[model samples]
Target chain A: MAWVTPVTNRNATARMTYLDMNRISGNISYLYNYAKDHGYDVQGDDVSQTTWTQNDIISYDFWYSMTGVLGEVREAAGLDKSVNYPATNYYSVNSLERYTLYTWMEITEPPEYGLLQNREGIQLQTESGADIEAGIL
Target chain B: MPTISEANKMQIRQPMDIMVTLQVGGDVSLTYSGYSDAKVADGRLDEPNKKMMPLTDLQGDGYPLNGSCKLYRPGYHPTSEEKWGERSNIGEPCSITITASESIGYVSAWVSGCESVTFSGNDYPVVNGTANIYVEDTTATFTFNPLYEDRRIEVSLLASGAYFIFNNDQIISCVVSLRSDLSLINPTLPESEIELQIYQDEDISERLASIPDETLITYSAGYSDEMSPIRNFYLSEKITWADNVMTIHAVDAVHKLDIQLPTASLLTDGSSDTGEATEESLLVFIRACLLYAGISIGIMPDYEDGASNSSLVFNRISLREAIAKATAWGRFGDYPTTWINYVDAGIPKLESDYSSAGWHIYEEDCGDVKRDAARKIKEIRMPVSALSFGDGGNYLTTNVGTGTWIYGSGAFLDFDDDVFAWSVITEQNAGIASVKSDETDYAGACERNALNFLAIKGLMEEGLPMGSMNTFYTQVMPWNSLQLATWNRYIGSSVREDQNLIIIGSKVLKDTHIQSFSTGEDDGEIITLDEAPIEGKLIVQHLNESAQTLYPNIAAQSILNMSNVTGSFKWKGDPRMQPRDSAYLHRVNGVTELITIENITITHEGGGTSAEITYRKGKC
Candidate 1:
């Protein structure tokens, strides 16, 4: 219904791309703020995600928990040893209902538009058989 | 299982009269050793059901073993004093006590018996725990601790016979505390100053002189099968005996007879100057006056039967003819009874008038002079001084002395300034004399009047001078739903409002109905209670039924439990329809099981029929 609006008139269209798995949860404000910094369009796919982003950003706090801890890197980086990030069980899959969107990239793809890295090593292709490029305006 | 004490095995002789307590503290298997006498024939005690069985036949566990029963032996006589006392002399004794209490400055107790004695103390007499040995009776004093200490008073009496005399029948002199400072300032009016005046057309002395002392006229009448059993018993068989009893009654039943004469009498001439003062006009005036009197002071004069459908028929005749005819009949009427006389007598052939038919005319002849007398009887009440006169203020025209005025009956043409006139009634005064002779006439009138005043105004004891308070004790029974509801609210609201002061004459039994008094703190005393009359119960039952009928959908079980229900039905319409008497019994006491109407009475008053219904709560 509604997409994120760009803060500057210099940006013709606003784009909201999820750089990683957490991008979908960070909400339109983070995308808008990022867009404002990079001078890009702040566009979001879902209106609910764009219209009221405060509720969504407050709920997406899982990223803050993991950033402070890494098992062996803490010793190498001189980080506090007592700091712990709760491990996520990736094997436990959530059942998909009607509203769930399953978007992932294929192998040999540089990256999807919004993801940081493709752990599954999937490649991205357009429906018109155009190869997904790593750097796009 | 444990054993019980021998003292605990007492029998409940009379259940309803007394409260019993059963205390079993220890762990126990309780059983009732059914009662038996302890006499045996041969070394064996003959006890009935000595082997302990289950307390009751019904199967139950941890059930209540202590309860009260209403079914009791009525003939249980408590200990009496005549049997307890050898001889007693009650003398006049005065005791005074100075009280620190704010309202009460000093209190004096006057104990009267035979001789006089005086005693003094502070606050109260120092007699508690003291023994006083008189010539005949021995009396002991005990300090009574009532629920409310304010009402506490030390009581002294011959305790042994007190129970017996109190329970069965005996009168105790209730000594009242008098304020010696309270003195009468004004002398009361003498008893003679209070006079009961009866204004009538004729002095009854002359008429009574020709009569026999005891005359019995009996008639048999059939009653409907639907009549109440009690009323049917009264009217059918008991009326004859009741009549005899009424004849013997002194004051209420024609005992004192005084004869006097008004200064003037009604005169009938051949012709009258004014056309309005004709026989018809005179009769109308008399009837009008009678109607006014009847309505103002609740009296119904029996004159004629109404339409066949009518219940109450009043005396309705034009003024001139009524007076003229009454005067004529009184003058020339014979003692002999006739059929036409009976028809004109208005003896109340119907049931409604049967009770009050005594006032109707029984027998009289209308000879030749009737027409002449009728013409002249109309000119009398012209308000002109010469036309009429009456006795002086100090003297009243009583039922004593004759010859001053041609009263009782007789046609007249004289104009006297001072005479008080009444239409002369004789055996010949048709429609009046016979109805007035019924035995129930006067009592029924009193009952009707009393009921009207009470129901309309909450006060009782009417028809008396205000100063005559001693004649009747004023007992104010609350009679409205609102009042009753409020009173009950007060009672349950707090322990403060639960206080009650029951003052009967001098014996004041206070501190009753208080909640905390149940814990044996109240003064142990007995009050001789008088049973309430039945008429009050009838009124209460009527209200209960009316409330039910008026609000069929409302919950009546709780409403009926209310203490007082108030509304008006006195002198508002037909006197009979109004509720005058209240029945204390109708106030709910025991638990109500159901509402059922019973003993309905339908009668006529003031030209209308009235219906009364009473209900009882229980399985009939």
Candidate 2:
């Protein structure tokens, strides 16, 4: 009889993902100032810095945030979840959650492309007629 | 009857006397000093006609509003970046703004309430409606910042932005957006709408911005070194006394005007080395030399290839026949007797060439001498090889040593003991190898020949201005130094400053050197040129007017050395960067004073007898 005992590697237990708030905040701040100086304002909006439940669980991970006003919470934290499944012979819970933890977090918005470069349909289609189908999506 | 010389002098003096009389008021009389006595004609004053002085660009208080227009296509930019637009001093209390609204394209602006505005060329455009104004004014009042829906405004300015226009003339207008006030209500729906905004400055535009427009009112001498004005180069000092040699040098104030002439075909190289020259080129050169002197000469015939041969025999034609003859003969070349024609027919013959070159000289319908004085008369010089400088091994050669140098001599070749028999190819390209190869010895030979020729002529001497240094030494340095005949033939002189200096265009290295010589009492004094301070380098010197000097900033030497004009060099070395050497030409601010190149060309060996060098046997 082979003595079989399972043990998880303690060294790989969990690593803290460092969030670069300085750069992100700085870029956001620049964009915000640029817009403000140019006489355009979305003053009520917030540049949030949210902490997701998968903060220490996922590799190369930092929570990404979208901006929204306080009343429009759905637009800000729209269905963020981590679906973690079993890797091998081990029952582990990849914690998934969307906790509006930093809903009031302040963020500096990075600059965006100017009025001329931002339109969508302005880009050209690669090929109107492909060999596969007419409206191939 | 007055002799021809006296008649010409009287003709010149006649107009002068009348003009003086009119200047002194209606009482104008000619005081004729007769052959043996001073005879005063009393009460016979020719009444002043008060002839109108011809109108020119310089006649008005302000250059008459040649024209004016607002500038279009304005944009915003960073504070440090340079913007393209006319820079003018704020003459009075005027507001100039580049306004950009959602409805209109950018337009240039000039808003002066009570002042004269002058615009340069059609390049300055002014459109109404839309503009993205980047104001450079501390005093501008944004009273009512025009605002509309879907519109954005961006403004930037350098510190203390003040326009410098002559008092009273307000300059306005820059980069106006295209028309946006058409049909669209909001005007923001259009996809390809042109909007003006600040962007990063590219390096090339930055360089283009720094070079100030150096306004050098130069008159071209025949076959001018076209490379001069286009490159911010100028010929400031030149001394000329001889006919055969002109030591040409030019300086690019920013870089050395060290242009090396290709040993190959310079004509096709976009370098204007026309094989044949006429009075057109002669006049150009003469005008260049005499431009500052104010002496003028009329056009002469292009005698090379015997263009004057036809017009020489046209004396028999009557005045009516002369006009008819002029219509029939487009160029003096078509006439066989041009050389023998009287001086009175000189104007007609020139008119003929002008017409053949697609210019209407005499309006047949109006029968008027369309004296468009705007097309001023100028002189030019043609290189000897361009005309007729013999063939092959029997070609002219200069033996520059302390010994007797025999040139233009048939005895040197030993063919038939009287004349040398060799087919000489005067065209520069004939001597160059067409295909590139290790055996392309011709190019090497040309370079060596150029160095020797420049050395012999004392052209590469020190203390010359920075402008001429690069043009001659670098731009057109030849490949063969032994081809003395080709080098000599290609080198020709014209008057850049009438009677005072000779403008020699060296094709081997498209350099224009004004030969400096002095006449009368101030001839021998060593005039130091340490007066006009340029960059930090001081071109200290002492030399006679007959000598030449080449002065280059130590920073510009690398560029010159790269061009291979290793003439005399002196460097003061840079203190900030130790152990690192710098070329002279790059020293933009270090140039100190009106420095000159000093060199004396002693053509005589021992007997001290001056020899007359001619282009062809009888042409000069």
**In model 1 chain B, where is the ten-residue run with the lowest total lDDT?**
B175-184
lDDT values, one for every candidate: 0.19, 0.20
Q: What DockQ does predicted model 2 obtain? A: 0.00
lDDT of 2 by residue, A15-130 (tens): 12112222223333333444345554335443443332211111111222222222233222332222232221112211111012111112222223221111332221212212
Top model by lDDT, which number? 2
Residue B200, model 2: lDDT of: 19
lDDT of 1 by residue, B503-560 (tens): 1111111121111101131333222112211110101111111211101111111122
Tens-digit lDDT track for model 2 on B1-620?
33222322331211100000000011112221111110111111111112111111111121111222111122322122222211122121212322222222212222211122122111221111112222322222221121222111111111111111110011110111111111111111111101111111222232223323321211110011111011112222331212222221222221111221121110001112121222222223223322222222345444434221110111111222222212221122222222211111001122212211111111121111111111111211111110111221323232111111122221111111111111112223233111011112342332223432232223223323221221112112232434345334443223121111111111121233322222223322322122211111112122212221111121121111111111222221111110001112212334421111111011111211111111100110
Query: Could you list the chain B TM-scores for each candidate?
Result: 0.13, 0.18
Judged by DockQ cut-offs, the docking class of candidate 1 is incorrect
Quote model 2's TM-score.
0.17
Instruction: Report lDDT (Cα) of residue B297, candidate 2.
Output: 30
Candidate 2 CA-lDDT value = 0.20
